[model samples]
Target: MEEWTIEINRSATKKEKPNTDQLEFGRVFTDHMFIMDYSVPLGWHDARIIPYQPFSIDPSAMTFHYGQSVFEGLKAYYTPEGNIQLFRPEKNMQRLNRSNDRLCIPPIDEAFVLQAIKQLVYLDKDWIPTAEGTSLYIRPFIISTEPFIGVAPSHQYRLIVILSPVGAYYKEGINPVKIAVENQYVRTVKGGTGEAKTGGNYAASLKAQELCSQKGFTQVLWLDGVEKKYIEEVGSMNVFFKINGKVYTPALNGSILEGVTRNSVIQLLQHWNVPVIEERISMEVLYQAYLDGSLEEAFGTGTAAVISPIGQLSWEDKDLYINDGKTGKISRDLYNTLTRIQYGKEKDPFGWIDIVNEANAVKQ
Candidate 1:
């Protein structure tokens, strides 16, 4: 394995780490970060560990106009034995490659990126919150930075990884969220960049998300663009339903974001012998099932919150309540079990946790 040279920045403040109890999501960042640049001739090079600071880029950078950017979110949890563990990081690495492929970006070696991430996490180990519902949120992104106004792909790019301490997503417990079934705005089409974690796809959803919020909905449940009948995904998550005591989610129809939490949840459900069916779930059928009480629960899965229980779904003039407006048994179980394993409270039968040793915790 190739190792990048390290350059330590001791200029960061030695102030006390923020109280995990009061930590806010995405608000508090770590002291140091990792960055690497890629040019057509040199490839990915000059990777370094540096102080968290903004970069100097030309005003005409390719990303400024074309929005050629991609990102991934994942977390590192501090275990009971004073070790930091990453949850299924390889999946995130693979997905990053997928996003790069779709965005016409060159794919980095998975092993190299993984190693770099591990090193970054180790350097900012103090930023890993230790509270029950707290963890270190890692954001890895690559952007086209070539100073050009052309409409084509840039030959230069920069990749950076930053870390932040975040508290529980729902401070008021795992409160159920309400969703608005959006039949008006389309999130992605059959051959769109929806499957890629690109910036454009998220920018496209902001309008609908704003509208959903203005209408008193927490998130917009997007539907298929062509027919707008089949359920696609939620704002930043993959939707799931519990019908007749079984878990059901929409299949990856090349339009849904394949989330890490979604994959973990599926694995957990199957491990527990719970029935989880992945198929094309139509909006009409989902609503009818909810009306008939077959849809006992609804939830969204993502890296940010892990799993968020959806209380109700509003579409057109009809509203459907899910499991008495509370977190269902399955949702609670999955959340608790996943968090347990993440926090080192439960056994990791699947070996998904990559525990970082203390010697390897700090950047060398």
Candidate 2:
């Protein structure tokens, strides 16, 4: 692993830290950003931390014209001892590289990316809200910069990381969310970039998401492109089901995004002796489970909400109620456990939190 050299952007100063009380998710940003340029010949170089500002891309830039871009989302938390840490960031790095592979984007060393994020977080530590359920949302993205009209991978690329102070994902409350099962539009198909965290997948889901909001649903529960009967995942998170006291999630189909929160929740459930089953769960089976009183709970996992419990799922004509339209016992337990570990309120038995204080965790 190569060490990242810090280039402090002293040009910016701390502004009024947004009222930790009224923070919004991914709306307000911090002071500085970390960026690097990539070229086929030079690879990733010219890394620096600079003031947060807009960039001027060529009208013909590949990313602008052809949509050759990918991104990842993760968070930084402030521990009780005033220390900063990232939760399972290695998983996010690995997922970003996986998305890179599928998009023909160059692979990045996880060590390098991790170091960059750590440096950025330490520099912008004040942006991390101390309020419970608030975090410093980190967005790492790669964009093709080759100014060409041709349809192909850009020889030149740019990777940038930005920080945002985010409050609780559910502004109204943690009340369970309603979801609309999308049977008409498919999120991803076999051998497609559905598994990748590319911009196009998100762009494709905008219409569906709009439709969801219009229909009084929080998000769209995406299904497989071919069968449409098999549940894949939610819009931006992985879906989970609990039937007959056993937890079940859709197996990693080629069309689903493997979320870090999804992985962490599964590991935590296993540690707590909860029965977790990953298999190809069909919509019909889930409805049957609900009818038979075997379906106990359902939720979506992601960085934003950690775990968002689903109250009800409505397909075109049918509606399935989950656990009296409230947060289930297992869902509450997992959320509390994860948040406790994050805020340093609970001992980290899984070695998941990466403490970032060199003076404490390491000797300078």
Candidate 3:
């Protein structure tokens, strides 16, 4: 067994902190960031926390050409007691490794990397926003650095983690918004990289998102790639539909990205005995349910937005208004419960909170 130690390089000067009230999603960054490099024999080495500045990379980096990259998004919150905490961060690391497997990137020591994240966040703890509906967004990403033009995986990689103060992922916040069902551009298929948290997956979604945004939609609800009828996910989150008092979300069938918030929502619903089912749900079935007045609520769940209520879903030019274009009871309750637990306002019955201690942050 080898010990994975991280080096610390404090920034000489601190950056100006953004106003809590004016914070937007991923716009303002912290003063420091974490970086680690990987090569053939050295593996992942030279883990360090340095100033948040850009470093030069080869123009032919494989990440830019072949797209061998993976990333994960999580958050750090300020509890009411003034303690810094994270919600289910271990799950994010686990998912990152899973994505690494899909993208042929080398595995990382999840526990060690998690410690690095804690240290980095703790070092910049003052940047965390205490205002309502605000937290520190964490992005952990790995990019292939080997400047190769071939279509194969690179031998060298770089893992970096940066922190951002974010207010809300959607302008609508927790309020309900309109979504358009994408019938033209499919997101991914069962055997594709759809399940991986890679740049390519998100890159593929931009086209559909652009089209939907032009039509005054907040996001596009994607269908499966093959037949293009089964519901896949929202552009940035996993979607759920409540029909006849039962909550149904698209099953994880190698095509949908397994969302941490989606899983949490499912567990919370089950804990409340709300009859949550994960199965293949087609848009036709959902539309039929809406026509029959059984579709009670619809929402998208992810780390970015936490929970986004879908008040209107447009499919084939037919508009379906859910809960009378208002946030439903379940959506409201879930958002409140999740956010409360995150901010330490409510009890964490699931043991999902991980506290960050400044003393245990860095080890030489």
Candidate 4:
């Protein structure tokens, strides 16, 4: 592994770790963070893991004005034994670079960044809550730091990684949730930045999310921006549908995010010889399946909720109830298998787990 200078915090704050049972999503943070800088000629340099603290960037930073930023989310799990692990971390780094390319930010060394992430997680391993439903959340992001007001891409940027302890996604196992199909507000268009994991894409989704929440729905199911007929994705996840013994999901049509969990589910299904296909599935087609009683199960895949069973979908004052408003058998099986693999409770046939060892992360 390439070397990164480590600066241990003198006054460590691990003793103040929050209670595991009371942990919420992204509400609590760990003690240390990793940072690196990038510029026109310097490229990426000065990698260090220092005490977690707020940055003092200038007010005119390009990220604030032009929103030249990108981010990725994954988790570090504490296994049954005393080791920590990551799930498909390399995929996240690769996706980060994809987003960087779209946003005009400088690309990062994925190998070095993965090593840095393992180091940071090991240093703060005490913050990895051992509760069954709790684990350390890893958030890696990059932002433009040039203090110039320009419409073009900034010349300088900062790559930062932070950790948080998130509680269980559900009180019990994964529970079903209701979603509102968004018809009025569109998420992104083809040939746009929708596929990239950028800030502006999420910023544009807040209004629709708020509107859907006001209607007693947990999240909004977005439609294609141009046609408003084909299904795109959920607000924070990629969707899947099981109908008549075959599984269907919206294809990656340049507008939907290519999610790690989504890919994993498709692979797992194929491994088990289950029928799954990726195509441009429209709402009308899915509703027709529901009308004919072929839509058997529905779930959304992402990092946060590994598998979210969608109980109902509301569209234009009409509701389509799925699986009798309860968690389906396939959704339950997927949630169990994925979570088991993630927590190291099952055999890792996919080589998805990255075991953390302190000896490899520390500098000589």
Q: Whose lDDT is greatest here?
A: 3
lDDT of 3 at 208: 88
Q: What is the TM-score of each candidate against the true structure?
A: 0.96, 0.96, 0.98, 0.97
- Model 2 C-alpha lDDT per residue in residues 1-364, reported as the tens digit of each score: 7765546565345766789888977878888788998898888888888878798888888998888889999888998789898898898899899998888889887888888788777777878998877889999999999989899888999999999999877666567999999977777798899989999998989989998899899999998899899999887999999888889999887888888888888898899888999999999999999999999999999888888999999977999889989999988888888888887889999999997765321111
- Model 1 misplaced stretches (Cα beyond 4 Å): 1-7, 10-12, 359-364
> What local distance difference test score does each model get?
0.88, 0.86, 0.92, 0.91
Q: Report lDDT (Cα) of residue 170, candidate 3.
A: 47
Candidate 4 lDDT, 1-364, residue by residue in tens: 4554545443355448888889999978888899999988988888888878898999999999999999999999988987888999999999999999999988898998998899899888889989886789999999999999979999999999999999988878678899999999988899999889999999999999998899799999999999899999997899999999999999999999999999999999998899999999999999999999999999999999999999999878779999998999888888899999999889989999999887655563
Output the worst ten-in-a-row residue range by lDDT, candidate 3: 166-175
* After superposition, candidate 3 runs with Cα above 4 Å error: 168-173
Clashes of each: 0, 0, 0, 0
lDDT of 1 by residue, 1-364 (tens): 4665545555356446788788988877788888889999988888877888778999999999999889999999998788788999889899999999999988877777877788888878878888778899999999999999999988999999989999988777888998999988998898999999999999999999999999899999999999989999988899899999888999998989998899999999999999999999998998889878799989999988888999989989999888889998999998999998988999999989987665555444
Error of 2 at 256 (Å): 0.8
By TM-score, the better pick of 1 and 2 is 1
Q: What TM-score does structure 2 among the candidates reach?
A: 0.96
Off by over 4 Å in 2: 171-173, 358-364
Residue 130: error of model 4 in Å? 0.8
Alpha-carbon RMSD, each predicted model: 1.4, 2.1, 1.3, 1.4
Residues 1-364, model 3: lDDT tens digits: 2587778989999999988778988888999999999999889999999999999999999998988999999999998889999999999999999999999999999999998999999999999999877899999999999988899989999999999999755445568989999999988899999889999989989998998899899999999988989999987899999999999999999989999999999999999999999999999999999999999999999887788999999999799999999999999899989999999999999999999976656655
Q: List pairs with backbone clashes in candidate 2.
A: none
